[model samples]
Target chain A: MFEQAISAMASVVVDPYLLGLIFATTILGVIIGVLPGLGATTGAALLLPFTLTMDPVHAIAVLATIYVSATFAGSITAILINTPGTSAAAATTFDGYPLAQKGEAGRALGIAVISSTVGGIFSVLILCFAAPLLARVAYEFRSPEYFALTVFGLSMLASISAGGAVKNLIGGIFGVWLSTIGAERVTGIERFMFGNYELYEGLHFVPIFIGLFAISELLVQSKTVDKIIKTVSMKAVKLPTLEDYKKIWKTILRSCGIGTFIGVLPAEGATVASMIGYSEARRWSKNKKEFGKGSIEGIAGAEAANNAATGGAMVPTMVLGIPGSGTTAIILVGLMVHGLRPGVYLFTEQVEKVYQIFGSMFVANVMFMLMGLYAAKLFARVSLVPTQILWPIVFALSVIGAYAFQGQLLDVWLALIFGVIGFFARRHGFSVAPIAVGLILGEMVETNLQHSLKMFDGAWWMILTQPLALMFLVFAFLGLCGPVIFSWITKQKD
Target chain B: MKNIYLVPLILSIFSLAVIAIALQLDTSPEMIVGDSMQARSFPIFLMILKLILIGILTFQFYKNNPKPVALEKYHTWGSMFLFLLFYLLTVYTDMFIGIFVVIFLMSILWGERRVWVAFLTATITPGLVFLLFDYVLKIRFPRGMLMNLYYG
Candidate 1:
């Protein structure tokens, strides 16, 4: 494993071509992340078509670097403009904007950069050591266990803080139904193709992702095209004094632990992690009164946790077939597009590929930290780009991206159709993330259920007899009901 | 019914339609195994589940008495219509031409009165896209009438 890790590092980090790709994508990521509403998921999805002809390792590395760097770049907007570039950085604005208002934007940015870098590197190390072990354990999983696991994954979406539980579940089930549109694998019989040849393979997820993430956001941006962004001026980022670090180092470390754990949980991501990190930092701080009022600890805690989540989110995505968060789900689609499947085989046979991801993320974290220190002012200027101009370009790119996949014009139409649906769905207070989760996991759930049923001679309920499957099934039940139960308990207490 | 009930109402109607379709799926020997679930079974089950959830959601909204949202801005709908037009143009004409025209038109519609910024964006974007996708990646777009005329 050590030898493979060294080889992976040498190939990914030392190779000039890969490094240059990483550097360029990281800058692109920074720009995307600094612009409010264009988060890491959209960036990765829009770029996925461009990476179609590249090597699998290099393709994934580009997406991963973009994910890592974009997550950190969000803090720049949060600190300077009081607008989070991504939802993950929403918590950063609590203290970040206040610091900027106080003429301490540089100090706030410094703490954010340092904490995010440290937290990101720490999570990558954890991902490196932990993902393989988890994959090894997952090797014992069979059809029933996998069915239960996917069910548990779907159920976990009920607890997502976005939209509402019932709506999210409905969206997930709807996505699963969408996935069932094509011909059945075992039977080779069409279900809902309606005689269209393109429907034979079901829907391509790339166009769907581009539509939902990129075009939907474009529709939303249309309303605010004339709105201007107000930014706090900073000539250059200033490094935190050693005394300042002395105060925030512990908070940063604690957030690193908190963020990684939350990120490892399915359906949770950096947004949730940063919120918990901020609250927990305040919970343990002696300067609680300073929170939400230019507290460096608050900035450190939120920034560290959000960036750390970019790495921690990769563990389940690579180890299991399940995605860890919304962005990782998009990354999973990117991987699937490249004919890469996540499981024990990927870890065992493609160990070098997994290590390449880790190395890329590590390099991305360090590179973005350096970039943040020197060139954040330039990146921050990206937010000032007129929305009327920026969004049209994004729209064009999205169309190209949708078309570039398979060189099909039909895919572009599909993207536009889904984009309209996505706009309406968002307008109605529904999160589009759960729909994606359902689409990605729907096949796994159906295939594994059929396998499990066949193995038990059509006795589907017999799956409960297996201890692992039973445990996961029980977890699935609890996961679906856990939020309702917790909220009830809180209500009772009140 | 309140304005918000349209969401659940539409979802329920759609679910019923899909379930009706699922019920009619073929159950021949080739498509169906001995006792295992068929392809339609999963979707039918999901539609039922969605129907039940839609019921819960309707009840929740009823209990909460949610307010009706204001109409969306003209620009939002205009942008979407323009985007649809862009798609049709690409389908009928060329993608690059579609891209250039839509960017310019979208900018104008969105109140970018500065002609130079709009034109520069419109021209430069397609140029870069052509250079990158056509020149570098070697991916050929379908020839439109204009391209056919030029090449021929």
Candidate 2:
């Protein structure tokens, strides 16, 4: 296995095109990542169609490069603009923006870049060395385990819902219901199509995601168009001072660990991992007051965890044919397009290819660090671009992006419809994340639930009878309800 | 606020109506894998859920009367109208020419005061897209009249 891994890494010869592609894609990923409301998943989805005709390996490399770099790139905006480019980077904005406000923007960005690279490299190494063993472990998992994993993922609702428990539960339940739309997996029934052929496949995630993030944000941007611009005009990019590094090293390590663990779990993606990491980091910090106010530690913790989560996300995707997050789910589709089934068998069946992919991720992580350091100033300048110009360009890109999907005009219509829906949802205060979560996990949840039901002769208690399944169910319940319970307890005490 | 649930309630009903209409269309037993359940079950379930959620949300809206979050004010009508008009126009026109024209109009509407900058952006944006998506990435876009007229 070690030999195979080495050979796999070695086979990735660094040619000019590969290097150029890596650089270009990473830079593109950074730009997309830095833009508020456009995240790694959407970025990957937008770019996926363009990769349809490319070499599968190169496609994977470019996408992976973009994915990891974009994850880190989100921090740049979070620190400078108080707006997280990706949901995972939201934690960074808590303290990062504050630090920037106090003229420590350079240091915060530097720390973010360095720690993001470290956390990313650490996860990639694990992916490289431990994928086979992990895949073997994952192969042992059954429907019950997946159901449990989903439960655990849903538990994150407790942390994400800030409005109130009832509202959050409503949102979450609505999400689960949304997942049940389209065609029934086991029964092969089309439920909600309203006679439209497009409803046959259920809802396509691209339009939904674009609606949730981009469209919703556009609406919010419309309302806030008059806010004074907050651009960081740093004289020079500041690297983290020695003392700053000393302070954040522990937080970085812990967050990376948290990120990787959350990432490796099926269904839980970068957003959850980052949120959990941020919450935990805040809970454990000596300078808790500095959190959300621009502590470098907060930025480091969130950035490190989010980037590490990418590596963690890939673990299950490479091993179990299950994606932990939306981005990897798209990647799983790409893998299927390449005629590859992701499972333990893949390690043996496509060892070199797998290793090369992992190896390429490592290279991408390193390249991001270098690129981020050099291009920080240039990217920072993007904040100066007026929203008037930015929104139109983004809208144009949306049109082109929608059209690029199967060259269908219907897709453009779909994007517009969803964009409108997203805009309203954002205005009204309903979290768009759950809607996306519903769309992505809907098929998996229904199919697995049905399959498990059949296996247990339609006894819902079978979820409890199976230890692994029961454990996961408990975890999910805990995850979803934990925050409400805690808040209630706190309220009572107060 | 009087009809907080008016939009969603109506939307849910419309969705159910659409689902009902679709059900009248030809569906096969092959479409139904086993038992009484089939591809239609999920959609029906979704419609039902939407009905319930909307009903509950409506009830909650009346009972609690939650205030609408303060929204930022902007000249959204102009932008929205322009976007809608452009989108409709593009459906009938060629994508390239339509896109170019729409972008120019949008930039102007977006208050890009500089004519030279607006023109340059409008022209170069499509060119960049053509080069990137068409030339480099090799994505075949909607050629529309341009392909038929120029290439053919």
Candidate 3:
């Protein structure tokens, strides 16, 4: 394992073509991240179809690098414009903007860039070591265990801060039902095709993903297209001074740990990680009063955690075929698009590919750090692009992306329809994440359940006989009800 | 329409309809010999589960009594309609035309009052898209009536 990993890293490091692609995509990721309303998920979705013709490892590398670099780029806008480029950077605005407001924009950006690099590097290291081990454990899992794991993944969606728990679950179930629209794999019987030839393969994931994340977001942006953003001027990004690093190194390190853990959990992503990191930094800070008032530690904490989450979120996504966040869910779709199925075979047979991802992420972290430290001003100018102008281009790209995936005009219509459904769903307070997750995991859940029943002679209850499967089911139950149970416990104590 | 319970109510009705449809699926006995779970079985199970969850959701929404959602701006609906038009234009006319028209019209609708700016955006965006996707990637888009006429 060690030799293979080293070999993969060496190959990636020496490949100028791959490195240049990484550099270009990292810059693209930064621009996407620096533009509010174009988060990493949307970026990944829009770029996914374009990557289809490329080699699988290179495609995954491109997508993974984008995910890594975009998380950090969001903080640039958060600091300069008081508008988070992505939801992941929302927490950064609390102190990042105020720091810029105090005319320390360079100093704040320095701390953010360094902290993000460290956190991202730490999480990449974790992903490098942790993913294989987790996949090995998953290798022992059977159909029943896989079914429980997917359910646990869906259950985790309930706790996503997008909306009420019940609403998230509803969205997830609705997505699962949507996944069932095509022909059933087992009997080759069409379930919900309604006699359409395109429905034979079911609703394509790429168009649906693009529609749900990008087009729906475009509609949302249309509501506020007339709004203007004012950017803070910064001469150049400065690395934090030695004294400044002394004050917040621990905070950055702690947030890296926190961010990675939260990111590894299903459904929770960089946004939640950053919020928790900020609050935890406050909880542990020697100068809590400085928080939300341009504290360097505050910037370090949020920036580190959110960037760290980019790597952390890839863990379950590659190991268990379960997405750790909305962005990773889209990346999961990208992975499948490239014919790389996540799970045991990927780790054992395609282990080198996994290490290539780690190498790409590491390079992305270093590349973005250099760009953030030097050319942040250029990227920050991206925020000045008017929403009216930017969104139309994005819509065009989204149209191309949807249509290009299978070269199907019907897919574009499907995207528009889903976009409308997604828009109203969000308007009515539903989070689109669950729907995406459910759609991704729906086939896995149904296939596994069918396999499990076959093995047990159609006695569904026999699944409980398997210890590992039972344990996962228990975890799924806890995942769905743990918060409520814990809240009740607190109430009883009170 | 903004009532929080309305979503669950609609979902419940949809689930019932799906269950009704699922139950009527033709499943041969041979396919169900080894496993009772057949093609329709999973969706039916899902719909049933969804109905139960919707029951919980409706109860939860009623108990929570959340504030009504605000109506979307006209621009939001306008964009959707514009996209629909873009799709039709692409289907009937050309992808390039659809791209040009949507960008131009969407920019206007999105409050870009300067016709030049909208036109510039409209022209430049498709040019870049064609350069990258069509020229570099070599992925040829389907020709529509305008392309056919020009070629003819």
- The number of the candidate with the highest TM-score is 1
- DockQ for every model comes to 0.71, 0.36, 0.70
Over the stretch A54-115, how does candidate 3's per-residue lDDT look in tens digits? Answer: 99989999999889888899999999999999998999999999999999999999999999
Ten-residue region with minimum lDDT total, candidate 3 chain B: B28-37
Name the docking class for model 1: medium
lDDT of 2 by residue, A1-494 (tens): 78878876766655567667888888888887887656787777667666767777777888788789889988888888777878778888888888888888888889989989988998998787668887777677777676666556545543442333333434555556556556665544555555677666666655555555555566556554555656665555577889988898998899889989888876567777777778888878899987877777777888888888999989878786656676786777667656667887788778878887887788889888987787887886665576666766666676776677566776776777676766665566566555555565566666676567666766767678888778778777776557668999999999
- On lDDT, the candidate that comes out on top is 3
Residue runs of model 3 more than 4 Å from their true location after superposition = B30-33, B149-152
**lDDT score, candidate 1, position A227:** 76
Model 1 root-mean-square deviation: 1.5
- TM-scores of chain A in all candidate models: 0.98, 0.86, 0.98
lDDT of 1 at A247: 95
TM-score of each: 0.98, 0.85, 0.97
Considering just the first chain, candidate 2 attains a TM-score of 0.86
